[model samples]
Target chain A: MHTRTLAELGDALAAGEMSSEELTRHFLTRIEALDPRLNAFITVTGEAALEAARAADRERAAGRAGPLTGLPIAHKDIFCTDGFRTSCGSRMLDNFISPYDATVVRRLKSAGMVMLGKTNMDEFAMGSSNETSFYGPVRNPWDLDKVPGGSSGGSAAAVAARLTPAATGTDTGGSIRQPAALTGTTGLKPTYGRVSRYGMIAFASSLDQAGTITASACDAALLLEAMAGHDPRDSTSVDAPVERYADGLDRSLEGFRVGVVEEFFDEGLYPASAAAIETALDVLRSLGASVKRVSLPNLALSVPAYYVVAPAECSSNLSRFDGIRFGYRAENPRDLADLYKRSRGEGFGAEVKRRIMTGTYVLSAGYYDAYYLKAQRVRQLIAEDFRAAFAEVDLIAGPTAPTPAFDIGAKTDDPVTMYLNDIYTIGVNLAGLPGVSVPCGFADDLPVGLQLIANHFEEGRLLNVAHMFQQETEWHLRMPGGEFA
Target chain B: MALTRRQVESIANLARLQINEDEIPAYVRNLSRIIDFVDQLEGAGTEHVHPMAHPLNMSQPLRADEVTESDDRARFQANAAAVEAGLYLVPKVIE
Candidate 1:
């Protein structure tokens, strides 16, 4: 049951081959036995999951089943799940139970899907590696010593290890794609506002968007179809029609023009990873997609601009955790200001604190013009560069990460080096475009990913191209030989 | 662009985070490194570019100002650290 994708699991439920209870139980048991090895989950809602699964079985029995009926999936702890804890991988919310379900959680639950649990993530989705998670880092399923790329690492790890067939992830500057690349899972970040952000915790609200991680593009498509739609509560939610993502998976890719970002192939990329991406491009060509080298020259500017913009927004967004509301509060305080300082100081982890301070510095009165406003202008240049490139091609392709997963502590000493992990993935978010990472092949016996990016809201075409390449390659099917496997 | 320890401390103070005295140096180092790294943006000329606040240049969507929500303050405040009679408890701002 854990091996089957959501689609196959749905089919089995419809065919009465297994009840949702049994399937949910199987995954719950796997998580219990396997998650300690990965720390992939922050909380497991076994009892609630079983109850939901039983209800799904009843739905199927009554001929009221949907495509996602009886399928169990993990929600990243960032999303608010009414009766469960939504930790967002930070101690600030460690004891905070959400009062309402995030829009994504509600939609999936409505489709008769059972929530297995909430997977861990970097605190407030800030770090490149899961190491910053207040719960402790999620280890890569491929190799225990290697870090799972983050802040969506736990979701990628959970899906890759088949702990749950799929999970939700949020990407602000490659949180979804980088981890998916490093852990060898399929991850997608839809266009900005394609999925409602009403209840997902804000981390750089403009750059933050909810996405999906799964074993294959087909499964990602399946989950995204259920999660995508406008919400009145989310002011930025796109008031456009949601694509039938799964239905578009079989679209033919004949004569598709794939723009290969020439800048992404420069010296920083690892050779073997480059080789794997080249092979994946050939597979796309075999499917009748032609590759052309297109440049988004302003690509180099995104990381710096993002460092400014993301933190600035986060500093403002996180101000709500001032020891007065739903999050952690100090036991006692000398004064109101002391209460605010102590509560936040003890509640948040290091990376989050550093970002808060960085944001504070950038948005400070004297520095605002030099950092915040300046970065926003550079952000415009980056977006315009993408708009220009999209005019010449239907999609863009590149290596998801410069290299495969690094050893857990390899780059942690220097924050800048750690930030570079998202070098290829951040530009997509800066431009508010949709992108997906598909397992292409392995480098140094570790998985490599080919990132496919499309213009705003072209997720159907992007998924179709990925599905076509995946049909010709078996990389996505290669399960890790970690403890669970 | 290397920030002094005094400056780092002041930044943390402004952010309402109490950094331990021993951890202050690392923050200074890391923050300085980050500032220096992002200094790369200084080279990009954007004299005429408009600073973007939204992606895709979409203006803020406007809708009629009307109450569409029923009161849920009680349910919403259920997760608060402290509350009394439907009011969130906080350190007194006035004596």
Candidate 2:
């Protein structure tokens, strides 16, 4: 039952082979038995999940059920789940019990999906690895000693371990895709504004977009269809119609133009990972897609540009947590200024503070033109590069990350080294394009991912291409060996 | 391009984060490395390029001026650290 995909589980529920309650229990039991080793979940709402699952069963019995009815899923801690602690993996928000649900949470619940609980993430979605999480790092299921790429590490790890069929994640810069690649799960980041961000804790308002981490591309499509749409409350949410992503999953790749990003195969990429990506591209070519070398010349500037832009936005967004409102507050304060400083200092993790300080420095009066605006201009250049490539090709393909999962403590010491892990994935967020990472093959016995990027609002095409690739390969079906497996 | 300890303190003050004396040196080193890393952007030929603030081309959507939500201050303030008579309490700002 745990091995079944989300679609198969939905079918089983429809055919009355298993109740939603039973399915929910199966996953809850797995989480309890397995998550102690993985630490994937920050909070597990077993009682609430069972209640939601029972209700879903009643709805199905009453003959009013959606395709997603009773499907079990988890949300990254960033999304505000009403009455639950939406911690966002930060001590600042650990005590926060949201009064309302994020639009993503509301929409998924409306689709009859049951929430298992919130998964851990890098504190305030700031780090490339899960080590910065307030609750401690999530271990990759494939190799327990290896780090799960993050800030959506918990979600990706949970899905990879089959604790949940799918989970919701947000991507500002590879938070979803990088972790998914490391854990060998399917991850998707929709075009910016494609999903509502209201009540989804803001990290970098301009770059942050909510997406999915799932076991397979089909599961990602199913969840994305339910999660995508406009919300009046999130002014940035695009008012476009949500695509029938799952319906488009069976589309053929014949005549599809796939652009292999030349810059992505630089010296920074591990040779073994490159080999896996090249093999995946060959599979695409055999599927009747034409592959060509493409260059996003300014792509190398993505890391520097993103560091400035993301932190600048986060510094402003996180200013709201100043102890006057909800979130952690100091026990005693001499004055208002002390309250602000001490509360924030005591609350945010080191990585988050570093980002906030970087943002404050860059956006400071004297440095604004040289850092903030200059990075934004370079961002435009990077976007223009993607625009030019898309003009000649239907899709852009590359490695999701430079390499597979590293040892848990390997890159945490050096902030710049940690930041560079996101080099390949950040450009998609900068341009606000939709991208997906599908498990391609293994390197050093660890999963490598082939990333696919599509033009804005072309998630249907993105998922379709991924699903087609998944059909021709068994990589996505391979699960981790060891205790969990 | 390494930042001095004084500069790090000023930046921390501006961000409203109080770093303990022991942590300041580490912040100085890390922040300086980050700044130097991003300094490569200085070579990019971004002349005449518009600074892209957002990826979408749409302007802010406007709505009619009307009250839409019911009062839920009590519910919302459930997580607040301190409150009195429907007011959020903070360290006194004025004497």
Best by TM-score: 2
The global C-alpha lDDT for each of the candidates, from Candidate 1 onward, is 0.92, 0.94
Candidate 2 lDDT over B1-95, as tens digits, reads 89999999999998999899999989999999999999999999988999999998679999999999999999988889999999999888888
lDDT (Cα, tens digit) per residue for candidate 2, span A173-257: 9999999999999999999999999999999999999999988899989989998988999999999999898999988889999
Kindly report which residue pairs in candidate 1 clash with one another: none
lDDT of 1 by residue, B1-95 (tens): 99999999999999999889999999999999999988888999999999999886777788899988899998888888889999988888998
Each model's fraction of native contacts: 0.84, 0.88
Clashes of each: 0, 0
The DockQ figures for the candidates are 0.81, 0.88
lDDT of 1 by residue, A11-125 (tens): 8888889999999999999999999999999999999999999999888888899899989999999999997788899999988889899999999999989999999899999
TM-score of structure candidate 1? 0.99
